[model samples]
Target chain A: MAKEKKVHDRVNWHKEFRLAPGYIILSLWVLFTFVLLGWVVGASFSTSKEIFSGAVFKFETGIHLENYAKAWNTSNVSVFFMNSLVYASISCVLLIVICAPAAYVLSRFTFLGNKLIQNGFVAAMGVPATMIVLPLFGLVAGWNILNVSLANRAVLIFLYVGINVPYTTIFLLTFFSNLSRSFEEAAAIDGCPPMKTFWKIMLPMAQPGIITVTIFNFINVWNEYFMSLIFANSDKVKSVAIGLYGMINSMRYTGDYAGMFAAVVIVFLPTFILYVFLSEKIIAGVTGGGVKG
Target chain B: MFDGAALLHLIGIGKGVTRLKKNKTMIVVFVTPAVVMFSIIFLYPIIRTVLMSFFKIEGVTDAMSKWEFSGLANYIKLFSTELFRISMWNIFRIWFFGGIIVMGLALLFAAILTSGIRFKNAFRAIIYMPNVVSAVALATMWLQYVFSPKFGLFKSIGKALHWEWLEKFQWLDPSHLFIALLVAYCFGMVGYHMLIFASGIERIGTEYYEAATLDGANRIQQFRYITLPLLKGVTKTNITMWSISSAGFFLWSQLFSMVVSNTQTITPVVYMYQNIFGAGNSMTERNAGIGAAVGVLLSICVVLIFIVCDKIFKDNDIEF
Candidate 1:
């Protein structure tokens, strides 16, 4: 027994040693992340000369508030920011409105094509945007709708709603299923109609799930780049992602690195704030569907 | 002519049929919008893309009447193109090599955070911070601030460590560009996967660890015996998610490259983008059909990986 204990102790020591490197790596990564973000924040307030001089943190010549203004106004980040806000908010709302009823029905009622719709959503979730985007581009462009500003935004929103339905529905399906049936039964016993039960009782009952998925959808739409890049490339309706990308591209000639970083910070600020305030929701929304399954 | 009992049964059956019809209408009312949107946007586009790959489409704006049936020529052309071959190789490397690194590190960090670590939430938040930022922003920061030769983080660290080779390294150079992009991408991805792993680890009850400890099992032994087996489902999910994300990799590549068709950073999606939009300088003519072919190929790769993962990591009878 004593010998066995000694062997176990030795095994324990080996395990500790193995984990020591992990702790070190984690610490280094944490340090690297902070330093990099801190540097970016610092650089945003400094002049290009100061940034190039590598004294970004010093702030010797005072902070450049003008960089933010310049990035917002001259660089057209404000336009992009507004576009992103509009797209993200409207799409998120529309996503919930459209997907909630479908998810609720799929979860609650067993009807014809119920299993088929569920399976389709699961399969659709696996299909990447690249698989459909090329043909979608062709379909949209073939309509000659790209040149019209309103049509451009409408098409983009339509694509967003279409693409996100699968995910939002799947995410909500679990939530709706987990909800107890008693409330709906009670409402039905009280002579509440099925539609009314869903609208008034169940929708509000699934508020937490709805809010979580909405937050996720909002973040996704806000950060979306590729589709927006393909469809809404015009200056009138470009998203923050493309706007910052265009700014970065032109900065090569403009040489306004400080203002460019300012644009980066501005574009990053909304989602960063969202993450800071509702991080728990964000994390839950991201991992809930995958982990639960 | 019927008996009284048979007439009563017929009346009951009619009522049941009407109820089912009512239920059907309700279901249709609830499900129609999602179904219609999905069919139009997702199903139609996917089938059209698969069909489009078999045709010769000159431009995205070209009508169906203009599409010439090219059969397997698009696929044949894609396989023959050197750039397409390079892009496939790059995506494969990203999927496999990056998969190992990201999953390994994420699982490790997740384990550490869940193992009675101090400030677990704070650490998890910090790790996940990069994911919240836009990819374009993150990539730009990496290019200008982290990988830049003049005042990059690497340069400062190299100077401090007195590492001459590191100081002289050109991260954006053609030879080093892929590695640079992969590293930056892995950095952003680690946090997202870490959260997934952390959630998985958190789902396991603490009683198991207590029971293992009482049996004199060491931490590593407990992790191996208790954690790994239980996390089979989560690992499968992570692998699938990683493959899907890696397959859609485009923004980072385009951001990292100086030009649209930088061979070093060209990915399958970027190649598809080039073919569809005719944005890159390398393409003589826009072939939307080839782009669709690349899309079809990438989707196949993802589906195959998902299948293989499912087969390998069969969720056996591990009760929660």
Candidate 2:
């Protein structure tokens, strides 16, 4: 009986030893990640004097809420926010409308050069935006495509659609392929035409995939700085991501670290909130979508 | 396009409905938007970019007087340029070395999170927080507090530790620019990629690890035998993204660091940008030909990488 008890104790000790290192490493990683973010938040709140003086951080007598106001007006972020919404939202809508049908056709049909076309799209999806951004810039500028009023915005929408089409289409194609076609056939049997069936039946059923694609596309368009910086040179069309650059760069001369942080928080707030609320859905959609695709 | 054998080949064969007669109108309607967008945005511009490479701007004024065909001159110039070569290396370093760092860290984090840790939600949220933050904002935040040389947190920490090398080195220097970009890029990446990996690790059943553990396998041994093999699909996903993404590194690198004068960090795109829309230093007429050439080269590189990745990964039928 004593020997059996001793063996049981040994097993317990062994389990504890095995689990200890993983727990320690994980705890340290989690702590460091939080601290880094906390440090950013802390620096934003700290006064310039507090930042430069090298003394222990002390809270200001009054919170620097004015910094946010300054960032809003000074950096022209209000315009940026509006423009970003218009650009990202419009692009997301366009990608779904266009890519959904494209994906559906690709999923359902087998035609001449279909595999090649699909492979082409997959290969294109992997193409980096950097590879083509400049050439696209040249093509647009040389043709003077943005010379017309609101043409730049249209061009941007087009570019966004093209950039996102490959990935989202591939993603959605996978989803559509897995979907049972019985519903579509039943709709057809009920006298619904193919286009109508696609619009009403397949699309509604594909809501989860659509939402996932929209979220990815929205984030990509919203936070994209490179293409926006090149194309949307006017303040009227700047995105929050690009607009934030002006505030931070201004710090080189103005040295207002507090305001820069305020700008970061403001720019970060919307997407951050969205993530906090919908992260589970987004993560599930992506993981699930990836597997099916 | 029809074959009885191929139809039977795919899973759920009998469930698939008979194909309707090829409706040209339906095909056109369904395919137009995708086709139009692809042609204008991708194919045309690619061809245009290639054509741009063969011509040189000939003018005393800012406006182009004529396009003088300078066959392969720009390509010759690009090859001869030290900065272009270095920038190519920088691209390779980021995508290659950076790929290993990112994938490794992602796997480690995914493993820990799925290993029955406490506070999974909070830990996942905090780690993935960087994904929600704009790259521009994240870069500014890092520069302001983290990488700031004078009185920056990292600088101060280095000073306190008497790390003399850091005290003397400014990280923004040209030689260190790649490193700086890597650090900035890695933070933004941790969230999304790790989320994908974590979900993947979760999807993998615990039975494999339990079975291994019962066989006297240590934690590391179990991870090696069970986790790594199961995570092959996730790892391949990472590879697909990383390899092709190198073709687009110019966008991130340019935004992260302001280009240094007298030296060009000329990725093909940056070079094209300089040619098409002149920046502060290089205000010249639009060189559409050269831009086209660079675009074609970039398009070719993109295709090449896809082929190379496929060859390397082979046919791992593991999805996701």
The best candidate in terms of lDDT: 1
Give the residue spans of candidate 1 off by over 4 A: A1-24, A291-293, B1-21, B259-261, B316-320
* Predicted complex 2: DockQ: 0.44
Residue-level lDDT of model 2, residues B182-267, one tens digit each, is 87677667666777778767777778778887899987788788767776666667666666556666555655556343232345
Q: For candidate 2, state the interface root-mean-square deviation in angstroms to 1 decimal.
A: 4.8
TM-score of chain B of each: 0.89, 0.77
Model 2, A200-246: lDDT tens per residue?
Answer: 89999998889888888888888886677778757676788878776
Docking class of 1: acceptable
lDDT of 2 at B175: 70
- Model 1, residue A183: distance off in Å is 0.8
lDDT of 1 at A203: 95
lDDT of 1 by residue, B129-186 (tens): 9988788888888999999888999989999999989888998888898889899999
User: What stretches of model 2 exceed 4 Å from their correct place?
Assistant: A1-17, A54-57, A142-149, A291-293, B1-19, B22-24, B54-69, B156-177, B195-211, B229-233, B259-268, B280-289, B296-305
lDDT of candidates 1 onward, in order: 0.86, 0.70
